[model samples]
Target: MESTNNIIEIKIDSYDDLVNHIKGKTDKCGDLRDNFIFRGLSNFEHELVPSALRKDNLNQPIVNDYVGGDLGLLVLISNEDVKSNFLEDRVHIDLGYGKWVSFDKNQHPFFDNNREYLKNKNYLQIKRETYALLKFLNIADKNGLKINTSYETRSKIHNYLNPDKITFWPKKSFFEIISLAQHYNLPTCALDWTYDYHVALYFAVKDILENKNNDGVIWALNYRLFEDNYNESNEYKLRFYRPEYHSNPNLRAQKGLFTFLINPVDEILDCPLDQVICREIKNIGKKNKKTVFDNGKDLILIPPEITENDIIFYKFVISKNAKLDILEELYKEGYSEDTLFPGYGRVIQNMGNRVMLENIKNESDKKPKKNILLKIKNCEDIFQRKINYLFGKFNFNSEIENIYIYSPESQEIKGYFKANEIIKNSPNLIWEKYHNKSNWLKKDFNNYFKDNKAYAIRINGLIEFNFPFKINNLSMGNQFMYIEPDNTDINFLLNFK
Candidate 1:
């Protein structure tokens, strides 16, 4: 079978949870099911099957549902709440397995028959995983999902369940192939985010295989020429796809997703993925904190922005404090030499950076597709400079917003091309429908920065400009460059002229 169709099919993004809801599931239960949706296979009809943990051959003519039919659907549900401190209630409510009901690992296949599994874990996480997996299995049981229940299917399922995200922590274990081979009938898979060491190593390799190819995985390891890209200690990682010991094109390609994870705030940020070895899959609650091997590792620290620092400048470090001089902040956390990020000035200094306000002149100055370069005398007049930077992430983000909204002057924000009936019609820069507090600031230039005294206004009484500012906390008064009345800097209006 073609690899595309020959997949160990699973579901994740598209299964509606309404069916489970109707079954009188939890009120907060998810309406969408998450699963391993694989679509690629080589054989289907008659394939060799392995005897499961039972050590006996599976029944011949494996149940149609049992034979990985059209696709493989393994739905897993987690009973653990993800947050419960089982350290106190460390005893497992013995149902079948030995009397050890603990969750050092996250993706333990949950069974409806087992209620003791519901221990300390995120209510939402376990809910999403558990119901999603089970639902897939139920569907497969009834109609025979496509996939084989053999050795290869097991390997793939294992890859999908544990995933690469968990290797940062090794203690975050999952069921062994033997145990998994025991209970599950149809292709089954699960997801866990527990903090563990040994498990992280296995998952790291598995993650490499499933997600990337060859060049990809190796690249995940921060290669060191002179310990410039990474620290010497960080270089202690082992490359799983090295040609001498490891030579698998498929395995190497999957490693590309690996990143050099560094957490400076926490003592434990060494949750290595591929090159760096990490076993730091902490409890589900720790969202983005760095996982260190012990609580003693020094984390990269940056000084918080002291608004009163007399020097109204900024530095560009890892975004710890809300403020810094500019984006040029850099300090070495590890032994590496090359600055991880080259600060903000380098970004703003680019000539073709194309701020939104300048885009109109840019497009107008250029023909259709030939090296588009537009020049403007003033950055303020053509359009508000701040808006351009705010929405620059999208080549079409401005267009989408314009089609949906209007502008400050009630200009009915649209492409200037359509209104002018010009030859090469370009969309207008201002969006009228964008009737939020942001546009309101543009409506009144004087009072815009009146409320917040910390503004850095410029441009003769017309527009505002702000770059690299996260929109959430910023207001016209606190952090913006505006043009107020009575001031006439031709730079603002003359840019368009």
Candidate 2:
């Protein structure tokens, strides 16, 4: 353990070590559980800055980039009269360059062909635009209104749009609107933290299972320090806010709250909130008398008088190898995606994590099967297009075989298809569908020579797995790479009914 910049950094190698260190801290603090809050980051390199405050190149049209991705549909308001009326003053025409779109009241175009338009707007404008969009969607959902668009586009984005011209807005407060947006994953300045340390630990190690190169970190904050010195007039003060959880079941289940910097000033731009808090504490300590502490066995000793210099923030760095074990332990304790996020949509979104845990729980009874793992790109989109099984050119000697379809985006085995029949050329119906809709498939088809024949493996049925699995010695560059499944991988494949 090392104390630097008023933050105590502790290295934890195992789940037991993490629990014990947290226990020791609580015991030393006289078990004031409510005074402490914890937040977890899957990557140790990530800072405590909010999504809106981060200095990243996010210069894309908000409606087409952010909202379209979530809704899984593109927005193309083709009605010329309607587009002209709504976008007359709101948008600037860029002609041959990329489309021009406005988000805030100032009507500043967020994107251009060169991607330099975002620099004109400040962070506050971006934040305001995000909040406005969320508020409009919330009101639209409440009123059961749909955006006027094509049937497919409307169906996809119907959950968050209102096309009717209305002057009235909802009665909800500003913070309440942004809070709901933050909970639903729309970026906001409020940073999520949980009262339950185990929940924090679960988030910290959740993503490390698939990508094991980076260590996870849990940020334990002693809120008592901030609460004791909280001032309403202080512009740089950091305060915690807990909205009413009666309407938010996920927040209630996770025991979550948010820590918000009162005012994100120019001086603190791109600075981590933890570092800012530590700097403020150090300044406060300079005004008061200092007390020396004894550092024995790398454990920080707190002085009898709780001063600003005391260890208020703790960063627990957990080893990457312990991620799977920690997730298994957390699963047994009922901290899972289903429990933490109570919704059908959320369950589908986190199906990969859920399947990984399911495989871990049912690892005892399993038999290894002769299976080939087939890596595929855009599996989700492919499934959405009603393509049940994948057909590609492969070199195989077997007449019948089990195939596991893997998606690189989810970093998991999406599903399985049993192939038994082989065709010399692409099937007429499937080829027609792909040629009309899928550009990548059409490109592949055009690249093949007339003499070099292609084979299509027809399958009996498709079974969706949607779980995370790591494959050793598998090259991502190969489209149809075959590998022998280990015991764990075999167990996972056998469980795929």
Candidate 3:
């Protein structure tokens, strides 16, 4: 563990160690309920910066070239009732003192030509435009009221042009819309944090998987510390905003909140929250003429009267090797992508992640091989005729390692087995166990003989009866179909238990 004033950094070897450390801070009687909020990074070296504020040289130009480019335009485009023509016309913005600027549909305050103006003014211009569009479309509106006309929309936009006009709407309403936009991948000044440590750990493991060579980090901030020291009169203050979660399932599941670094004088500062906090602490130390230590990076100033035990920030670096273990543990605790992000798209993404993890585990254990789908016709007469041909006479593909059996009659994939498992077992043993037994067994074997060359594979004691799903895009007459490794269906099948 390395300590720097009020910031402590701990290197964690495994998931258990991470949990134990968090429990030590949270489980004590003196600890306030939900004292800490966490944010996870894929790389331990990453700084605590919001997505919109990150200074990416290559992408910054693209983000600034258009309004809401960094934030995403999906929220704007998805509303069918909201016409784009409302914002297509050129409009003049008053910069005060008779200085005026014109911005068309493609131009924004963030453009290079507008760089001479104050950044806070530019930031407000973007926000006003975004809020106006949202209000015009009635997207996630608390009252669900629409602006009805382009004139009304323009009026709302013009109203927010002035700095003092921000107070026109209730504070909660303003933050709610911005938070909603942020949730949908729009770039915002706020950083996302979760009250649940497990969610943070899950995201950390997820990041480590994507960047396999890099170690992950989870930053835990003492919520009580921020709450205790927060002053409304401070020139620079950190504000915590928890939007109502009823409208956003993802936020509710993740127990998410946002931390905003507010500079009343400037309104915008392109620095991480930790650095801002450290700077404020350092200034306080200097005012009192107390001894202060600064590392220039990850600095936190502690007064002489304060003890090290009152540390407010912690960073835990987790080893990349523990990624899989942590993910499995999180899944068991119901902290998975499907739960955290409730949507059809996230469900598919979760399955893809499961498939990738399975492939990784399989590759680590043995040589990887291809998986194939074997479709069969479900009929008793067809099975009796092809029983002799499919058991041993018919040659199976050597490259095919796993065979998934599909039934046409039921339109469902019944189960699967390893190609070698079925081939190594004698034909007599398979026939004895499955032949003339249950009706379902007969249908499964019958499908193998429909096309005379054993289109379907027979399932015996060697086969695993898991992974049953409906066969998609296959015609009723198409009894024998071979699926390649790259087929999209493989992702769903591989996710089976």
Candidate 4:
């Protein structure tokens, strides 16, 4: 009998052990059919074995399915939504562990240009991330740093940079560079997955610690099965990818894989995959209505064919009780920061996580002291009429617009504003709110200020700043709206109240 110590095998004792871990928090009516555990040695197993088959032994024989032979198991952490959320309602509804689907973190904002460029435009993000990778390579070259890159990588990056060059590089090469860029912290569409169960648990537990309120999930899916499905289906255009990039030590350590999202956003913004497919079908049917290839099934935009019986997707929801235990077990098994992140620099970084001073406070913390010399009370409400008047005239878009749906013209104007810090006679009504006589009259408003006779002014256009004008109900014993530019005080609306 094998030692049952292999990283590939799930550490849980039996099927019952796994079930018992989640059984406490799981609702009685919760959908458990989609949820399955690996009874065998290798986690990659098809056919959901019944809980009755779980004996005292850790190792069990694997079963294969005709449809999905042996796919990776996916673990999903249910957000425990009482009613289905936005993403849950739209994407992969059936594959969810519970009634709710997987939680979408929706792109972390820490990455520099993610919020700026890549938030809504998933297709554009692929090209942009490529460009960013090229830029990094250029910087490395300038510094005379030797990067272990191939001719393919060098050639593709060149063509990518020079748009008119008619660049032709293999998808494999492009994926390599993208993977390398991801390793170096460039925001790409690819979500990282690992084969090592311990490493996966570590990532999940780390997230759990940071987000204590929410349940953590370990999601697994068979890449091989997905690839096979892709070849057969015309609906899903995405590829189940595992990059061959071995340059990053962390990548190697984690046994990482990536799901390469291809052209995620279709023609228009927020158009669902099904809707896009429907439009394509309409167009195709109009051209050739008699096209019945696969049993009269329209081969348009197809959602990923994920089902419980297929056993391609699996999710293990780690409740609060299970998280600490799993993390401790992983730590005991030597899956720690030292092992995962090798080398002195990373080890030092890891130590910072452990060695922490007490979150103590000094004398300044105890006994609240009076800091305010004078407190201004209800000064802002005094400018209510003027503020409302300006707001009403500003022509703000009533139909809630975010960064994703921002118009191309608006994006261009914004880019210009970022570079030059001024917009010359901008037509965007959102800019109209900044227009006022008080802003133009300020002395600090120099050549940067572009003001029209209608008192339509743009001030510090690109930079984020607090309101330039403050409503002073009592300044020098008089009520007025104060605007300061280079020590010059401009007041508007003399006291009547």
Candidate 4 regions with alpha-carbon error over 4 angstroms: 1-126, 141-153, 156-170, 207-212, 227-236, 264-308, 349-497
User: lDDT by residue for model 4 over 1-497, one digit each (tens)?
Assistant: 01211111122322223443233322211222223211111122222221211222433211110112111111122545423333333223344454312211122222222332122333332334455566667677789965666786686645653322211111445666556555555554445566665676676655433435444545444444445546353534334445553557777877766644334233321232223333444454345222122234333232344332333334555444345445555656777677787788867755553332111113213533211011222223212322211111121111111111111222211110111111122222223335452323333333333231011312212221132223233232221111223223221211110
**Every model's TM-score:** 0.19, 0.50, 0.54, 0.39
lDDT of 1: 0.23
Better of 2 and 4 by TM-score: 2
**Reference-based lDDT, each prediction:** 0.23, 0.57, 0.55, 0.36
Q: How far is 59's C-alpha from truth in model 2 (Å)?
A: 7.4
Which of the numbered candidates is closest to the native, going by highest TM-score? 3
Best lDDT goes to which candidate? 2
* lDDT of candidate 3 over 406-458, digit per residue (tens): 67677777766666433222222334454553334545554544432221244
Residue 166, model 2: lDDT of 17
Q: Which pairs in model 3 have colliding backbones?
A: 71-186, 71-187, 377-447, 383-446
Compose the digit string of candidate 2's lDDT tens values, residues 1-497: 56786677877655755775676532222333567899998888888977655443555333223333122111122345325545434343344333344433223333222222233233333334343455555566779854222343224233433322211121123455556667776666668999999998988898854655678899988877656755433322355678778778888999988876544222233478777666555655454322221211111112223455576788888777567778888877888888899988767756777676567536622534356767788777555645544555564534336777777666677776776544433233335443443344555664652233344555456777555465554455566645454555555645645
> Compared with the true structure, what per-residue lDDT tens digits does model 1 show for residues 390-439?
21111210111011111323222212111111011001111122323132
